[model samples]
Target: MQLLYEHRSPPRTGRKVALIITGALMVVALLIFPPEGLVTTWSLWALACALQLAGVGLLALPPVIHLWITRREIIIHPTGPVRRLPIQHIHDMELSGTEEDPVLTLHLRNGEELDLSDWTDNVPEVMALLAQLGVARRDA
Candidate 1:
């Protein structure tokens, strides 16, 4: 079966809310509390707000992308392009769970570690697929 998935690492929802609120506050400050040189001083803040908004938008793109897994390989399609990695190349899998960050890390035979937590939507499903394909868990 051909299963598709995407890689996405987005700021947490709380982070997004905070960014929006902060940006709004900055906008309000620029409007209500104009500095002596408001135009020049506020321009930088305005630019920063715009950049933050763009980042929020980018964070929303990962769920829309999908990964495809089959007997032969795993395919990850992000916003811009598609990436394919053969099942044979995957040497080990590690599930990273810490107080701060929880992620699934894939270690390839070629000595590459691919972090999938940010992009993968259904991690258990991915784990099942990998297990079925005989991928060993390094952490275990």
Candidate 2:
């Protein structure tokens, strides 16, 4: 596939590693002190577990943080299963929301509309690219 446009977010690997380390330290601290009260111990354990789980979840997430459009498809790089949308399947592109917080909506041929507000901030640029690729906007 021909490369059209790409936008990426900075890496958060270091932050995720730090979170995992912090959670591990919490676990160690709980083991050493064994909180005085039963309720406190349980609370500490819960916190430790939550921290560890959150760290692991973050680590599992995909690193790509923006939309990647090619000649054939629009690849959404978010934490989800439906990542690729074919260009041919897109019926129209629509922009909504306030000017300060614009949202790009993809109206699929099957009638499913995808709100891309959360995935991308470069709304106008993306809209332009899609238009150049011959994907008509809703008004057109």
Candidate 3:
């Protein structure tokens, strides 16, 4: 079967806003008082701003990172690591009830359950996508 619905976590707007504000403040500070002494430097402050900006940018992107689902297997990339699980290995899929109680538990053939809640958005569309992927509610 063809790969279908895809889902991701919500954009980290609050973190982005905080990063932008901090970067702006750092820029203003650097402009007002440029670093002079070797010990008392503004480089660290600049680096911090850059790192925060990078973090916010990464957070705004999809949390799925990498996903490929086929008739045989499903692969997920979380950070630099990759996990590939065959469809035949999956026994059951469980979807959590509410946003506050969000979770996706995958029961594997090996009797191991993997939770995929942190990688998806808490939305109805996402829930529907899970259902389409054969993830049924535990209560159901």
Candidate 4:
């Protein structure tokens, strides 16, 4: 029996808030520093420019939006390098570490292992998934 499910992670607004704050500060700085003057070099305007680019670049990073898993495989999208393992190839499922920051490990064939705890936002959902997949879910 093989079943797969997908769950969209929660929205993370901290980045948006950070971008807004930084943009506002940059506008204020530009207004005060006057881009026309040679004083830009002396007043660290270059630093502001670098920071703005970095902030915008970070927005391109894809969040942990979807997790697709079945007893045989697990996929994380939209940047998935899907791992395909049959149920028989999954040796064991383990949960370790502190309650607040526990780790979930799936021991696979040929000494391979999978850890999904890092980017996972909702642990309870994953735990339920593991149970459904006959993983013998562990209490964190």
Q: Model 1 off-target regions past 4 Å?
A: 4-63, 98-101
Instruction: Score residue 117 of candidate 3 by CA lDDT.
Output: 64
Off by over 4 Å in 3: 1-72, 97-99, 123-127, 133-140
* Model 4 residue pairs with clashes: none
lDDT of 1: 0.73
lDDT of 3 by residue, 1-140 (tens): 57653444456677777777777777777778778876566565767578677767776676445454555566676355878887667777776667677677778879898876655444455446556666555554
Ranking by lDDT: 2, 1, 4, 3
Model 4 C-alpha lDDT per residue in residues 1-140, reported as the tens digit of each score: 34456666554557655765776687677778667657764465666666667666766665554566766666656356654556566666778877888777777767887787864756667767766777654343
Winner on TM-score (2 vs 4): 4
Best-to-worst order by TM-score is 4, 2, 1, 3
CA shift of 117, model 1, Å: 0.9
For candidate 2, the per-residue lDDT at 94 reads: 91
> Of 2 and 4, which scores higher on lDDT?
2
lDDT of model 1, residue 57: 82
Model 4 is weakest, by summed lDDT over 10 consecutive residues, at 78-87
Instruction: Give every collision pair in model 2.
Output: none
Task: Summarize candidate 1's per-residue lDDT along 1-140 as a digit string, tens digits.
Answer: 55444345454777666777777777777678766776877685877588579658855744445566778887776345878889999998988687355578899999999987666666777887788889988764
| Candidate 2, 1-140: lDDT as tens digits | 77687767766888888878888999999888787998999998888888888888988876675777898998887344548998999999998788899989999999899987777778898899999988988862
Leading candidate by lDDT: 2
Q: Pick the candidate with the highest TM-score.
A: 4
